[model samples]
Target: MSKPLRVVVWSTGWIGSIAVEAVHRRPDMELVGVWVHSAEKVGHDVGEIVGIGTVGVVATSDADALIALRPDCVVYAASGPERDTAAVPDYVRLLEAGINVVTTTSTRLVYPPTFTAQWRDALETAAKAGGTSLYASGIFPGFGSDQLALVLSTQSSTIQKIEATEVSLNDHYPVADVMMDGMGFGRPLDFAPWLSRPGTIEASWAGPIHLVAEGLGAVVEEVRGSLERALADRDIEVAFGMIPAGTVGAVCTRAVGVVDGREAIVIKHIIRMARDVAPDWLGSECDATYRVDIDGDPDIHCTMTMGEMQGHAAGRGAMVATAMRVLNAVPYVVDAPAGLLSSLDLPLTLPRFALRTAHR
Candidate 1:
């Protein structure tokens, strides 16, 4: 048998660490190195940084040193307050070196089209010039927004409209600060701010909506957003931290891309904490639900509901699933088109064990 693919894991954050675990368990992949942003973590064993046993790999922040290793691929899971500025450059550098790349950045949804147009073009050019490939995808807008929408289209003949909805209890927050502050949890919030804001949650999903609309052979003229918040008066305990009960901590946002004032594609996101007691539209026990509505010949509708108890598991599953997808595509990306490619454009096939293992 041929030697396993050598992969460099850049970043040890939440998703990065999980991707490390996923890579280690795969028989076809080998972990060769790790990259981190913290100086304190430098020189430490990669296994310890990921909470696994020693694997002989040491963590370093030196990009030049990492590039010198000549890894076959780079799984980038770096998180930061400044992701667009700092993290993106790292991935681009790797791509420029002709190394395959897969990332979980939310901004990745707009590749080659909306956001990072120049960078996307550059990466595509580099990948093509170096015979490498690069792809980006995640669970929310990545899977549910793009892939699932594409799947729903298969059920339609003359598709007219498509709608995707996601609802979750706030318990899915991985980091307390981001959940409580970045999301404005535990505060008397106004939904208007997020809807009217240029770069808020509503705006973030626009990329996926546009992607789906274009894929469905429709041109979206305008987009509209609506949001609701759940408030409590007391505090509730959660794995991340305590969120004030009865405070405006949970938010439900719905954005619709319109063609002639009719909804073509709808993206819905609901995030809530333990204090949220509001009844779900479908009445599932504090779980997350994804529903796709397709108006076509047969009127296709597909729904997936994940139990609330599996929120953490699902988040981890998303990380693993996305990583495995990237890992599986590395070989083909070497000869793919010369431009930013989304999950839709890349040649991706789910690994058989990925779903079974992630569900566990």
Candidate 2:
């Protein structure tokens, strides 16, 4: 059999920890090392940190130590509010060191298109110099944005419009905190706040929309956002804590892509807990839906609903998928342009032996 892909996973937070477990389960990928932010976890076994059975690998806070291992790839799943700020530095470092990288950072979606010219130039230079590749993709703005739209394009003889939606009922604090505090989930609905905010929900998904639009040979003329909130009637005790009832703690965000003042693509994101009142218009509980409408000789409407089960599955699944996809591209990154790269540009086919090894 061919040698296993030596992978070093950075971080052991929620998604990061899960990704480590997923990598351990794969047959063709060997967990060689781990990078952690805490000194306490530095000497601890990776399996212990991630709550899996013992695997000799230990976690270290030093990036240089992990890099010295010369891993074929690094699966970056570090925990933080801003992926660009928290993860990009490490990503650039790894790329410059000639290690292939795959990350769940939000900024990864716009690498080739919307990224800052400096960052873009740096990444490309690093990759070319190091002969390594870097790529990013995930569930929300990643697959939901690019992959789904790409899939829909296959069905359309001529494409006209695309709309995607993600709604979830979550009560966990850190997760909910990102939605409520970071996303302004319970705040007053206003376009001014979104327009002024640089990385808010509206602007965050713009990269994905632009990526897909560009892939489909369409140009986005205009993008607009709308936010809606649902107030609870009474306090509800959830896994996180007691969220006072009647508090406006849920939000629905919509972004419409217009071509010549006509709606061509609309993206909607909804974050809510089970206790929140369901909207009469949307006709569903806390669930994600992706709908595509194509105007052609025969009109086409395609919808995909990810309910409680699928929604819950998304967090960990997307993380694992992103890591595996990235690990599979280490060879290309080692040989291609550096800086930042998108999953759309990577080879989708993974080594069959790697899949078998991962499963084993």
Candidate 3:
């Protein structure tokens, strides 16, 4: 307790860079090492790479070398194509080396029991062998759906249904693959989105559905995914590209949890390249908003948005929100018992010494 917690950050992507700046300013945490995926980033100071003034900790691509340092925890922020499925081994490797890991990469690990039996066994076994913990969390499946929904249920006398819906205005979102390919925006109506694929939604979002049900003492018999795409009424230009008239401009997708042969939990998203594209779809006051709706004897609605000035949203700040959700949990995760952890197991994560001057 006399020394600051030793911390390492993995990857230098959007999520990782924000983590570097946050950890550097925290008085109770010491920036130890940074792991980068790109070869060009090797040997550069992490603070410089993240655009903060240099803080002396240089970046490296050597995974084994960082493990040798045996930091208290690693903020595994690596994200790319299929990271949720591909990054399990990376996390297990760190756990086996006796290093605690808190990541925003894997959605299945949000509730460790929700993943396949093989992955579940592997993570549990690794954590047991090394006596460390692994916690996965982020905005959607992590907070808005699972944790936030459960907290709101405390007020209701009777709970019948829980749903987390995001009506996001993503015209300002510039990620090409996510905008065009993942959501099917600017594509033909017949174009198949990855979400439309069978089991894809369940694989990505079922953790939160199961977690919500488990938290409420219910059972989920099935999870279903559905999609609806609206065509652009006129020529629409987005941050990534254009959506011509009669082309896809909006998508409304839902992953529903059927419990006791009834719709109990749902994760719905109405994503738009232009707000007016889906006139009748769910709309928000800001550019992006997450609304938790609990239908029961006394209905409860909770709305959440970040970095909204007036009605516009800070698209870049969204990444920072995701990064901090895990970063703030480091103290609890490091001290917790060795195993896979979810929001259910963690105590209130306080941002200790964050208001004081930087200890760097």
How many clashing pairs does model 3 include? 0
Local accuracy of candidate 1 as per-residue lDDT tens digits, 250-345: 667788888867887888877656523554443334356667778778888888765434434434544555555555665555446655677667
Candidate 3 residue 262 C-alpha distance from true site, Å: 1.3
- In model 1, how large is the Cα lDDT of residue 244? 70
Give the per-residue lDDT digits (tens) of candidate 2, residues 207-291: 7777777777777887777766776666665565555665655667787777657777777766665533556435333245445
> Candidate 1 has what TM-score?
0.85
Cα lDDT of model 3 by residue, 1-360, tens digit: 568899999998888999999998887899899999899999999988989888999999999999999999999999777775767887789999999999998867888888888888898999999999999998776787688888899898887788898777778777778777887888898888776788887777888998888888898999998888999989997788788899898898889999889998999878888778888888765646788999996899888875564446545556777888899999999999999999888986777776776356
Query: What ranking of all candidate models by TM-score puts the best one first?
Result: 3, 1, 2
Question: Candidate 2: what lDDT?
Answer: 0.65
TM-score-wise, the better of 1 and 2 is 1
How many residue pairs collide in each prediction? 11, 20, 0
Candidate 2 stretches greater than 4 Å from native: 107-111, 173-177, 186-199, 281-297, 305-339, 349-360
2 or 3, which is superior by TM-score? 3
Better of 1 and 2 by lDDT: 1
Which ranges of candidate 1 are over 4 A from the true structure?
Answer: 1-3, 118-131, 172-177, 190-196, 280-287, 306-315, 352-360
User: Model 2 TM-score?
Assistant: 0.84
